[model samples]
Target: MRMEQLASRLTLKRAGNLVCSVCWRRYKRSSIVHQWSRYWITTRAQSPSSRPSSSLKGPAALGTQPTTPPITKKQFPSQLELRAVQRLDVLLEDCQEFLQKEVVPTEDTILDALKTCRKLSEYFRSVKDQPALSTIKPGGEAGNLLFLDADPADTQTASSRTLTPIAVGRMASSIAEEAMDKIAETIKRIAVDKNVYITSKVLQEVVDILCLLNRPESLAYIFILYSSKPVPKPNQRPLKYTKANPDRITAAIPLKVAERALDAAIKVQNLPLCLDIIEHTVSTKAYKRAKTLRGAFLPAVAVAMTPGAAYIVASRLAEMQEAMSTSMMTVIGTAGIITYIGTTSTLGFIAVATANDQMQRVTWQAGIHLRERLVREDERAFTDKVACAWGFADPRRRGEEEGPDWEALKELCGIRGMVLDNVELMEGME
Candidate 1:
């Protein structure tokens, strides 16, 4: 009879928990809850009390403090731990749109987003009783601050923004590495899941982050992320015309100045700015058709030019100028374009020749020194066939410092191009 009662109660409880039926059945003597309680009490009567003592209440639960719920893979979110991921998410979406519908970018603009990432790390570390910081990853500087001010995806004009597709990819990589678990999970899903469509902006941000990582996998991921199309960062600073420079107000800049700025920007390994300076030098001269280049780069030129090399190169340049002029006159017979080439031909040739020679020697010397510098710093065991540019350029190639000489080479390349234009030009002539 006891077993029968227990079985009936169990059946009633199961039925009650499953659903409340509206069937026309007779009501039992006891309710499901009452039966459950009475049975539970009787079943464990000889055991211990499972219910609380009723003393410790509410927040102050009895028996070993109610421990905070542990973070689970499903429960703990990245946003909670990585605030930077939140900021980066907004930035990445915006940048990816820009890259796809508009401009692909470098990591510059997204750096602010990464700054938040550093904050996330700091916050996370702090929670773990540790301090956090932002460390400059070597060669990761190209897209570092590139994305500070990005333009809308459909915005016209390069001046609208500097965010490039390449940069966007890099930022994504950074988020993947540093963002909290929550944000990272989302980003990874975007990067990998096939069904879900990852936007161009998101992929681009991923590229920016991965490029900074300078890992082959990151690079590969970038390609995979953008497997649909090959994209390049559009021209951002197109055709800007600023006053030549201070100290000299003239119709044009001297050749020396043009070479200097271009060289210095290269030598200091400031290629991010170097290409622009080089373009400016060439364009301003081409359009102005002035006897000299823009003067803005004068001070830098004066500082970098070597007098001894200048003289020899200048002499050679003068001979070439005379020969070209003679040939031009012989063909055109002192007419048309040749007539204009003669306006300040004599003086122009002399100055250009000297500047060219000086530029040549400086480049050679710079190369030798730059190689030494990179070698020392990274301890690169560069073979005769190798010429590594940045620290992360060769992900697989390793090197030991070879002293200050190796480091010097890198510095030279940083501020100066490895090959001189004059030398290349001369080779072309020969």
Candidate 2:
């Protein structure tokens, strides 16, 4: 009886060791315990009749575990993200209020709203593909902590919040499209009434939007306002106007903005407007060192219009031949002489006009100013026509003192050594 008991105990101990070794190997390799291995070993060790099988092929033979889907981490908004959302909400509210108000908003108010609208548009574009989360989940400790400090008011605010970047952007865009006339009027008022310095960054943002809206006329208007020289004090107050003591005129906008305005004018193909822009550029003090006024402005016009001038000369010569029975050689010689004189006078005029006042005085005394009188009285009509068509305002005709605007002569728009380039718009020559 003792020997049988000993043999049974040995067999049970051996079976227990085999099951433990297999489980221990599995745990070492896979880092997970087989659930049934502990129970099987204990039952066999106690009973000894149901011996563990050595033919066991490991944890796989115990049947597969009931497969479970993974528990994915839930995303929650960080403090920074929450703050950004709050800021965006406030901006949208302000913008909506501005849009709904019947009265036109102030310049600062309008500017603020515009900036908000732009921010919303940009934000929507950036996050268009991203999933939006409205609220935190109630299951997790992180989610509970996220809303722990929130009062009833915050909860109500969160619940009532209807603003989204896309919604705000669309609202602003649609309102702008619907009431463009009012927008134009407001912008015109801002340009004329407000003297406060608007940064080029803001101006550029507005300009880009205007371009997108296809409001070229408004763009042209803005260009004219910014680029053109401000009306002299005397012009503004006609009672104070005097030819000899006229107030100095300076442009309100800086050089770069003025250039943008010129491009805007040219885009609209408004010749008179182009001439006005050129006049402003010529008068700008920054272009003094360059040959903008003397070499580029008038000279470019003279060159471009030379063909038309030649045609006029040829027509006159033919008329003279028919009336006086003159030879073709005489007519051709007359035309050549006229062309030579005209070209030489134009060059000489440019040189003298750009010279010091003393030199201009000498040239004036040398009867250079008398050249216009020697031309036929009939040609005066043609000259006036050309001047009118080109929108050329003779600086000499203006009796104002030719002095720079001392106050505005400093570096503008934080730019140093800036100069307006010579861009000759020959749209009217056709």
Candidate 3:
């Protein structure tokens, strides 16, 4: 009762002044007390006891009422966020388990052995947490905890032994197909989820594997493009398809894969990969992206476009770069010139590659000339057109009459490095 009286009196004292402006000396304590009592008496209208209870019917009654509830731990995210982290942990564990038990081990011998071992080691590591209540059931009823140190040598790995060529080829194709299918699904899922969290290379091993497998085709195209500098005519089939069968199945499997690979290659801005893929695309005649055989020629425009190769050739073309024709240098002693255009030292990779290709054109002409000479030695004129394409000068005139430039051209392409001494008597060319 006394405590209630103290409370009521204190509340009244505090409330009346509002800002506590009343100085204790100027306003007598008894006077302030009288004013507060009067104010409460008027407000509550309760019994005039020493204890003017807060329960008295007025604003004072509700002033001491319990406030808006304080928030509990349940109302905040502290516990929920922890739960989410736990869920992610569980998801990771589940993924490990799925890979171990579900995925059939690949028998491909070339797959990195250490990588597969680490994969297994990581899978069963979560078994440490789950305490077992049963004896025979063991640590985890879901699955037996894999014994890490159980056996060493006998463990069957992906790279246990080298595969036969036939088996290796089949395995390679299967691996590629698997990766392609997986990546396709993954890309689709990412699109569906609108997810940006997913990354390339690490999680997308499947995609990387598939991309790497398609590398042979990529390499082939690079070789072809490197050899053939000039883009073919619009009428040319595949730009360099079997000149024999220019109109084959224009759209094929390898061609489609190569096109897709090029698309991805451009996105990542990978030069080596792009160069390789471009080479392969050209070699395999895999220009499925092009609607027609002629359309594939667009890639030719971009060939040797990489800065490292192109700028080096462009910047140092004068004294900076020169063709290295060692054979020509051997025949024509460097009188004034120390080294000819095709010398080993001065010649660029591009020049070497170009010369080699020009040589192939020479061989092709030789073959046609051989055929024509067999049928009719008469049409020497037709062979001249073929000869011109092979860096060969006019056939009508003698060497001196053809002029200095023509003679130089002839000297440069002399003998074509053919081994006439060891020529097989069986084959006519030999």
lDDT digits (tens) for residues 199-268 of candidate 3: 2222233233334333222333322332232322334333332232222333222434444565555455
Stretches of candidate 3 off by over 4 Å are 1-184, 187-206, 211-351, 354-430
What TM-score does candidate 1 reach? 0.23
Give the higher-lDDT candidate: 2 or 3: 2
How many times do residue backbones clash in model 3?
Answer: 14
Best by TM-score: 2
Which sections of candidate 1 miss by over 4 Å?
Answer: 1-185, 195-200, 208-216, 229-335, 338-430
Provide the overall lDDT of each model, using Cα atoms, as 2-decimal numbers: 0.33, 0.37, 0.30
lDDT for 115 (candidate 3): 30
Query: Ten consecutive residues with minimal summed lDDT in candidate 2?
Result: 68-77
Residue-level lDDT for 187 in candidate 3? 29
Task: List the candidate numbers ranked by lDDT, top first.
Answer: 2, 1, 3
Give per-residue CA lDDT, model 2, range 39-128, as digits (tens).
222211223333324323232333433232111011112221232344445554555555554443445765765564444333322323
